[model samples]
Target: MPKQIKLNPLSIYIHIPFCVSKCAYCDFISHRVGDFEINGGVEAYFNSLKTEISLYSGLLEKSKVRSIYIGGGTPSSVDGKFIHNLIMQLKSLANFSDEIEITLEVNPGTLTEEKLNHYIASGINRISMGLQTTNDQLLHKIGRIHSTNDFMTSYEAIKRAGIENLSLDLMFGLPGQTIKDIENAIHLVGILKPKHVSAYSLKIEEGTPLSESYQKGSITLPDEQLERDMYHLLINGLAEKGIMQYELSNFSSASFESKHNLVYWENEAYLGLGVSAHSKLNNERFSNTSRIYDYSKLLSEGKLPIVEKEFIDTSEDLFESIMLGLRLNKGVSINKLNQKYNIDFNVKYANALENLLKQGLVILTEDILKLTIKGMDLSNQVFLQFMED
Candidate 1:
């Protein structure tokens, strides 16, 4: 008998790049539905997505998919039937693990009970809802379409639908935001008791509406000290709610950590579909075309629609492993890294390790190297130490 090839576990991320309205701070590749609705609507995009999936069917057949994350400019903004059909199509093509986790990212004022029902029936076991802040004034200031009431209604509906795996996304460090606002948001988390919380500090990306306004001096964000204060408050507040810190900006209740996100942080291989999506498979990392027309045109020509690709050489791979692994609280197992890379971790990274240790950034307990709380705060600085200079 011929030797059997070992199959690897995979994760899938499907992007729904349609939004009801764009937020001021967002830099994600998403189009307003009104503009695209006239030009063949989302149906055209879904067709192209199916084509992309078909192109990867052989690869899918060789891997067992463990997680599927349907993210977008509010995936719930569109008709639920489209999402249901898409999930069914993927199921037909891939060998899904029996304990597969399917997550759908939603926005408030867009999700209805009927739409949520469709998602539940389609096997979406997890829902990540965006509730940037509870203040209505802040919602308007940030150009968000939903109010606190809208988020409350949508959140309650998800709970009533019996979908227990819920994750709430919150943002700090917005213009005109105060400590009181963050306190209120944290209090709401305690009251709501969500399974997971992702608290991120705002970064004003260049060319974004918020960034433009900031550049014009029309608005001013909280100072560096205030932002740091807000982050520490988040860490302390979530702990009081029994949501322990697992990653730098993520908190979860017990085993409720996001498996799909873990795949990325663990440097595992996964496939990303749809326009502007990125993927790391085998030894190469690649991304699809960001333009809708270009994506559809290439797919119609029976091509992969990939616009960029790069091979992750062993040196780059090791650095990535070290960088991503440190993002977790448990940190990386040096023994495993040594075995996989065939090197002594201490000897190979002695200089970097010495610097990190002296700076109180990282500590190695036995064979595991993990970041201290201070290191987590200054994670970018720590990652820089591991780079091949």
Candidate 2:
């Protein structure tokens, strides 16, 4: 019999779906409530997470965990004790790496000097803060609770705590926003000198309040050309400051790229825990129940979360590898493609791939395939054309 190929090592994502308040344009599975009710759910969720990790203990032993990220509703919303307890529990559940990148997603409003200090002591080396935009008017328009000044306070607190691996999130093309506003926002970001930056345009999801506003004609946003201009300007501005664009919206100084996020772009497997989180293990992808009550009820019965799962068919994995590989600026190796999947990216997607080349959307040289400036702009359409059939 042929030897079974071991899966690549896993990264872990733990979702803390509790927030102080939900933004009008936000679509993540985050909750908002009084402190007491939020506090009540922390322990139960962590226990459920521990139970989930226990099931993968064997895989954990076989693979060296790459990165561990705690995201969602602001993870910093929880008290220091919650963070401490959760970290301790994770430590006990798996053979986690000592040098692994442990990132904690925080909101500016929830972090204080003391809280940041405690978080650092608890083994969180990387911090991702959601700043959205520096314009107070735009911030308020989006129903974001944190003001620019609040972000400054929290940023300084993180600095004072000596945590340097930092990333800031920004949004563009919001309602009533202009190129001037984007310029101002970019300048404000320069003041912070964040090691990494991720600036995405506001996407109006169907169920979001902002989307409703758009549907009712209460607000109007920039057109595609303007949005593209904003992205180009953002890229140029960040590049002038020595930041390199690693993926579409993510930028970082040479040494500050998010290791945790890189796992996904590299097409590696990862385990996700908590309500609504998705996991990719042994070529199968699964998501937990989105409803908190359902998740808890199922956990109470000693059942592992398995709301939905699909084995990534061989062809789907091929398309996934291409889609993910193209997202990286470096692209993927042609030789490795043959060794792993037995098909080269250039060969498998040749027809549409040639059309892109003729249209100047893709470029190939030295055994690597990458997107051109025009390609990055139309990348979604390009990737969609090659998806699994």
Computed on alpha carbons, the lDDT of every model, listed in order, comes to 0.92, 0.82
For candidate 2, give the lDDT of residue 261. Answer: 84
Cα deviation at 267, candidate 1, in Å, is 0.3
lDDT of 1 by residue, 240-280 (tens): 99998999889999999999999998899999999999999
Which pairs clash in model 2? none
Q: List model 2 lDDT by residue over 301-384, tens digit each.
A: 888777999988878887787788888888767777767887766677778877888989888775888888898999998788
Cα distance off (Å), candidate 1, residue 62: 1.2
